[model samples]
Target: MESGKLLKAIIESAIDGIITIDNRGRVESLNPAALKLFGYKLEEVIGRNISVLMPEPDKSSHDGYLHRYQSTGEKRIIGKGREVRGLRKDGSTFPFRLAVSEVQYDDRVIYTGFIHDLSKEKEAEQRLKEYAAELEELVNERTKSLKKMLHALSEAKEEVSLSLLKEKELNQMKSRFVSMASHEFRTPLSSIQLSSVLIEKYAEPFDNPHIKKHVSKIKNAVGNLTTILNDFLSLERLEAGKVEPAFTPFDIVKLSEEVTEEMQMIAKEDQNIIYQHTGIESMVNLDQNLLRNCMINLISNATKYSGEHTFIEFNTEVTDTQCIVTIRDNGIGIPESDQKNLFQAFFRAHNTGNIPGTGLGLNIVQRYAGLMGGELHFESKINEGAIFTLSFKR
Candidate 1:
């Protein structure tokens, strides 16, 4: 009797809903959990068809399913758990998991069903899906923002690189300017000072030959100063876009002769300038002053770089469509490595280490030639000789 009471107490207090049905499918007993799940009182549901707690089509077809099982002794949902819908007394439907089992009595069989509500589990699963979608959208937005930041950083880096490059170029130009001002200006200034002192010392004794020699030295120093000043001024004007070439008809051969004669005064001792004219005509249309400056630069370089007594050739040829001048010198020729930068300002050759120059002559000459619609090219072999050719369209 005590064991029976204990079993009754366990079933009454169980959390899952439990119900018993007879062989005829009539409700034999209902637990407190089952009454609460179906919203029915013990007396109201007892002896009624157990299908009363089911939602349609199960409500209509469950009796048929039971009768088939009883006749054939075949098992369908017996001893297995399945998801099913239940009807409440308020005519509402709820989802639940149902497990059924059978017990054999002395003369009949009885069936018992266990029920568990699945409303909370379904609701929790739906909440998880919503959270996953929201997280994916947040991640996409963050990725887009990161890409934009990277693009902005790339642009900033490019701007910084350009700024540094411009600064480097400016520094290089300033250094070259300082070097030019120091070397070019000091040489002529020292020469003029020494010659003036010597001229003063010899003036008291009145030596003609000595006075004349010192005067010539002073004149040459002054001329050197003038040439340096002109170079600087021309560079400034070119950079400022203030120089324009004026072309006119002129005798190119006669101009070359005059320039050569002037350069001979400053030529090395015993050096001779060999002038040759091969063209049919000596006249051409060009910028006279600019042409003169270009020739002066070339002839001066030939004289300066050649040894004493070396013969320098100045040849001019005029054609129907062009005028060409060639200046060939037997001097220390340019090294192959230095030829590429020969026309760059402030660039001196490696072989001409002791040669006194500002390194601006060829650069200025090339620019002037370009302005006159002319071309200047050269060929040289180290320790042998060099030839410079200038051509202009008529």
Candidate 2:
């Protein structure tokens, strides 16, 4: 009697839900845990078919399974754990793990089932599946955005390449036009100059001021046009990389004197260009043609900008280490702001007013100096004077 009470106490105190059924599958007893798990009282479930606590197909098949097992002694759900659903008192269902074991009593048989709830684990698994689907969708959206950006960059690169090709063709055509026009205009310009000189010579005997003035104007206009054509031709050749200096042994003193004499005829009224050689050595190896052109350009600038009776200083020096030439003039000096761009092609100083110039002389002179491996630098002050120095290493 004591042993029977102890066994009952142990079963009632168990944490897991426990239930016992007769060989015929009728619920005979249940622990307190089993009663609370199904939301039923012991009196309500006692003597009822065990299928009352089962759900769906299991509820309907329990009786046949029990009969088959009793007759054939086949163990299908016996001595093993099965995941199954239990029907609650409110007609709702929940998942649980059920373990059944057949117990042999004195003359009859009974099945005891232990039940562990699994509702929480199943809910957590469903949540994980939903999270994985959301992450995949985000990855797909980012990939699509990246592909669109790459496509736009490719299109932009192609457009830039096309623009560069068109610009190259345009530059080549412009160079060709300049070369042809300069050569074509030269013949007419020479004829105009010659005719003006002849007109001046013939009209001097008549002493007509109008005839002399008009001839002078014609000569000046023709000279200006010739300068423009020459500037354009020089720039075209430089851009095509065709201008190279030819070095030779020449008398510096002779070249300086010759350049001054040639340029003196074109100077502004009464403007004097003084030529001097300060160096002892008279002969030096250099590009004679290029040097003559540079000296002529500088003197012309000085003569053009200076007022009547102003003096332009031209000096040359040849030392053991270097050869130097300097030209200084009192003229409408370049502004401090304009000095920086003095050697840029087609860029005239802002201070120049109504002056006949192509603004390409200094640029060409600088380039010519560079081809001879020389340096050109200058100094100027507004309304005062300007000085340019050209030097070559020995």
Per-candidate total of colliding backbone pairs: 0, 0
- Looking at candidate 1, what is the lDDT of residue 179? 52
> lDDT by residue for model 1 over 1-394, one digit each (tens)?
9998999999999998999999888999989998998899999999999888888999999989898878898754743478899999989988888888888876889988888887776665454444434433443453355345434433554454468875455544534543554565556456555655554454444344644554555555455555655665576567657779999999888898898898887898999998999867988888899989888889888988899989999999999988998999999999999999999866789888776665788998898889999999999999877999989998
The CA root-mean-square deviation of candidate 1, after full C-alpha superposition on the true structure, stands at 37.1
lDDT of 2 by residue, 1-394 (tens): 9999999999999877899999888898999988988999999999999999998899999999888878897764643478889999999999988888788987889988888887876775454334334333433443344335434433544455478885566456547656655665577668667766765675555466766666666666667767766777787788889998889999988999999999998897888899888868878789998999899999999888889999999999989988899999999999999988899876799978888786889999999999999999999999898999999998
Could you say which candidate leads in TM-score? 2
lDDT on C-alpha atoms for all candidate structures: 0.77, 0.81
Task: Report clash pairs, candidate 1.
Answer: none
Q: List the residue pairs that clash in candidate 2.
A: none
How high is each candidate's TM-score? 0.50, 0.57
Sequence-dependent TM-score of model 1: 0.50
Error of 2 at 348 (Å): 0.9
